[model samples]
Target: MTSLPPALLRPLLCTVVLSTPLLANAQEQRPGVQAGITFGATTGAYAHYDDKPLVLPALSWQGKRFFASPGSLGMNLYKADGLRLSAVATPYTLRFKTDDVNDPQLRRLHSRQMSAMVGINADYSADWGAVAASVKREVSGHGGGVESSLHYSYPIQAGRFTWVPRVGVVHSSARLLDYYYGISDEEALRSGLAAYKPGSATSPSLQIAVSTPLGTKWRATGVVANQWFGDAVEDSPMARRSSQTSAFISLMRAF
Candidate 1:
C-alpha cells in the first residue's frame, strides 16, 4: 500500500479548491466571498508514487485591494488599463515525505518539507490574450530558493462554455532543485543510490481549462495540465518519468 503524505494534502487542496473562486471572480468580477467543495486526483511523477485523491471545502474572497484565494493571498498595488501588479504570499508544495514513496530505496531518503513563498506578480490583459509573470522566494527556511515563471493564455467562448489554453515555463534555482531532488551523500549510502546535486532548471508546461455556468449563482470548472521536467529533475533517482499530469474539477457558488 502507498502512504499518503500529510504535506501533500494542503497544497493540493488549496490549489484545486480555493482556485475555483478566483476563476469565477475573474469571469464575473463580482465582489463577495465564494464557497464550495472540490474533488480531484493527481498522478504523481515520482518513482513508485500512486494517484492521490483530493477532496476539500474551499473559500475565496476578492476585495478592491486585497484578495485571498487557494494557495495564495495578496494585495493589489497597482491596477490600471489592462495591467495589474500585486504582492503575494503562497505555499510552496513541490515536496514529499519518505513514506509517500513505494520504492524501498526511495523510502530511505529524507523528506522534503513545504515552505512559504513571498513574491510579486504582474499581469496584463489585452484583446488577444493575457500574460502573467511572477518571482517568488522561499522564506520558510525549507529551501531558501527562488522561483519565477511566465505564462500566456487565451480564452475562447463557445456557447455556454469558456475554454482557456495556457503555456508557461518555470525557472527553479539551484538551491530549490537541490533541496527537493538532490541526493545527499548520507542518503546515497542509506538508499544505495548515487549522490546527486543538481543545478538550476527550467520546466515548461501546457494546460487547458474549461468552465460553464450551472445556474445564476453556481459555476463548474475543470482543468487539465501537463508539465515536462528539466534534465536536472529527470536525472534524479526519485523521478520515474520526464513529465507529470494533473487534473482538477470544482463547483462553486458566490454569495
Candidate 2:
C-alpha cells in the first residue's frame, strides 16, 4: 500500500470515522464548551525521544453528549445507555533545538518537522467506570501510524479528592509503527546512524489521577500515567524504547 503524507492523513481519518450518528436516546444534554490547559513531562527508553515537558491549551465542546475540539477533535454518540461511539484527531509538530539523549543507551536524535493524526474509538461502560477501545490512523504527511488501545477507568474517594485509575493496551500496524519508529536508508546515511527496521507495535499503560472540586462551577485534576511499548513496536527502525510517564495538574470550568 502507498504511504500518505501527515498533512493529508488527519482529515482523511476524520472523514472515515465520522459516520451517521447512531440515534437512539437523544437524552444527551445540550452540547456545551470547555477550555483548559495541560502541563506534563514524559520519560522513555528511546534514543531519539526523551523526557520533555508539554504545556498546551485545550478547548472542547460537547453537543448532545458528542465532543469536538481544535487541538484534538472528537465526538461520542450514546446508544442504549451503556454503549457509545467516538472518534479523535490529534497532531503534534515542534522543532528540536538541541541534541537529546535517548535514555538507557544515550544516542542523539534530531527532529526538524512533524505532522498530525486521527483515531477511532469504540466504548462500553457501566454506571462506574467504562471500557474504551480506540484505533488511530495516520493520513497525510511522511510520518504516519495506526494505534489501537483498550482503556478502563473508575473513580474512588480519597480524603477530599476524587481519585481515578486508568489502564490500557495499545497495538500498531507496521506502517503506523514504522512511520514513528522507522529510520529510513536515506536518513541513516545522512545521520551516520545504522539503518532502522520498523516493526509491529504493542504497549500497555496505567494511570492514577485525583480530581478535586474547587467550587460550584470549577474543578481541578492531577494525573500520572505510565506506558510500556511492546517489542514489535519497539524494535522498528523508527522505534524508540521510550515509554511515557507523565504528571499533570489542570483546572476546569463547566457551564
Candidate 3:
C-alpha cells in the first residue's frame, strides 16, 4: 500500500471513535416533527376553529407511538390492545351574528366571547375499527359546560394508499351549547340585532380520509367531512351555519 499520511490516519481514527457514540445518541433520541395542511367541512378556515369547510396547516410530533399537535396539544398514552388516554385543548366561542330567516331591519347580533377548553378522551382501537369516547369540561369562557362524543373509524388499504372512514355523534349540555353558540340580551342590543335563545344541540357526523405514502418518510392525505344536527342544538352562527353537509380536500406529510 502507498504510504499513508499520519495526519490523515489520525483524523480517520478520531472519526471512527466519535461517530459510533453520536450514532447511538441519535438512535436513542428519536425526535422528529411533521408539518402539513388539513381541510375539514365543519371546522371552517381554521380547521380547528371554524364550523365550516376550511383549509388549515397542521403540525405534529410522534415519539414511540406518543403523538401530539397544536390542535391536540395535550399528552396521550395508548396501547395496541384498544385502550387510549388523552388530554387535549381547543379554542371555542359563545356568541355570534347571523342573518335572520327573512326578517328585515335586524342586523346580526354579537356576544363575541372567546375561550379555551381542556379535556380528556378515552378510546378503544383495533385492526378492524376504533371507537372513541370523550368528555371535555370547559376550562374557561362565559359559562362552563360539558361535551361528550362517540366516534368510530375504519381503515382500508390498497397498494400504497389507505382509506379511512369515520362516523361520530356529539351531545352538549345546555350550558355548553349556549356558552359557545348562544347570544345574550345585552349583546343583541349592542350589536343592533335580535337576541336568540340558548338550548342543547346534537350533531351526527361522518368523514372520509384518503392517505398515500409520498416516499419512504412522507405521506399525503385528503379528507372530507359532513355533519347533520339534531333539534336540540343550533349550528354554529359564526361559520357557514349548516345543518347541511360540506366537504373539503387536503394534503399531509409525516415522518
Candidate 4:
C-alpha cells in the first residue's frame, strides 16, 4: 500500500528506469538543459493525501559524463561505446500524508520523511533497447536501507514522436520497507493497529513514455506507469491497496 513517488520525483524514477539521462544522447559529450513545467496525478494507497493535478517545475542538465535533475545527480566514471558506469544520488519517496484528507485512519499513521540515496549505476545502450542496474543506500535515514533495480527499455521513433516502453524489477531493503509500511509499537498503541515489521521485498513495474515536437526549442513529454507492491508491503495493516499508478505530461524547452 505504499505510494508512487511525487510528480517531480516521478521523472527521477523514469531516469532510473532507463538508468541515465534519457532523451538526450549520453555519449555525445555535450552539455544541455531542459526546463519547463510538468503536471500530473498519482493514484495509490497515499492517494487520499497526495496532491492531484501536481504542478512541478522541471529542470535537467546533462553533459559528457554527468547529469543533474531535481531529484538526482550523477557523474559517469567510465564509458566505452554505449556502456556507462556512474555514481549517483537520488531523493526518497515519503509516506506521510498531510492533514488535508478527512480520513482519520489514514492521517494517524506515522510518516517516513524523505532521504537522499547515494550509490552506483551501470547502463548499457543498444539499437533495440537499453539495460540498467543501480544500487543505492539511504544516506540520512541511517536505517542502512538499500534500493536496487534492473531495467530495460526500447525506444521507437515515428514521425516527430518518440515512444519508450520500459519494464523493470526493484528490490527494497527491510529498513526501507519498514520505514514506509510498518507500524511502530508506539504507533500501533496510539492508532489501534497492530505493529508489523517487514523484511526485504521486490516489485515489478511497467511504463510507457512519449515525446513529440511542440515547436522550435520546445517539446512535450507524457508518461504513465504503475507498480504493484510486493506481498510484504501489500500485507501491511496500513496498506489498503495492492498497486500504485501514475501519469504525467510536461512541456520542455531545450537550451
lDDT order of candidates, best first?
A: 1, 4, 2, 3
Instruction: State which candidate has the highest lDDT.
Output: 1
Segments in model 4 whose C-alpha atoms lie over 4 Å from true places = 1-30, 47-51, 98-101
Worst 10 residues of 3 by lDDT: 20-29
Arranged by TM-score with the best first, the candidates are 1, 4, 2, 3
State model 2's lDDT. 0.55
lDDT of all predictions: 0.78, 0.55, 0.53, 0.71
Candidate 1, residue 181: CA error in Å? 0.3
Candidate 2 structure quality by residue, lDDT tens digits, 1-255: 877655444333322122101000011122476556555444433445434444545454677656665345676655567787776765532222223433322233344334456777677778777787877777777556666778787767788787777787777777765555556677676656666766676778787777777786566667676777787655644444546455666555667
Q: Which lDDT tens digits does candidate 1 get at residues 169-230?
A: 99999998888889999999999999999989999988888888998889887877778999
How many backbone collisions does model 1 have? 0
- In order of listing, the candidates' clash counts read 0, 30, 8, 0
Output the TM-score of candidate 1: 0.90
Instruction: Give the TM-scores of the predictions, in the order they appear.
Output: 0.90, 0.72, 0.68, 0.84
Q: Tens digits of per-residue lDDT for model 4 on 138-230?
A: 888547789999989888889888888889998999998887777888887877867899888899988888888778888887777788888
Q: Show where candidate 3 strays beyond 4 Å.
A: 1-31, 38-56, 64-66, 77-80, 93-108, 187-194, 235-246
lDDT of 3 by residue, 46-124 (tens): 1013232334455666666555553445566654566868776755422232322122322444333445667887877
Superposed Cα deviation of residue 19, candidate 2 (Å): 27
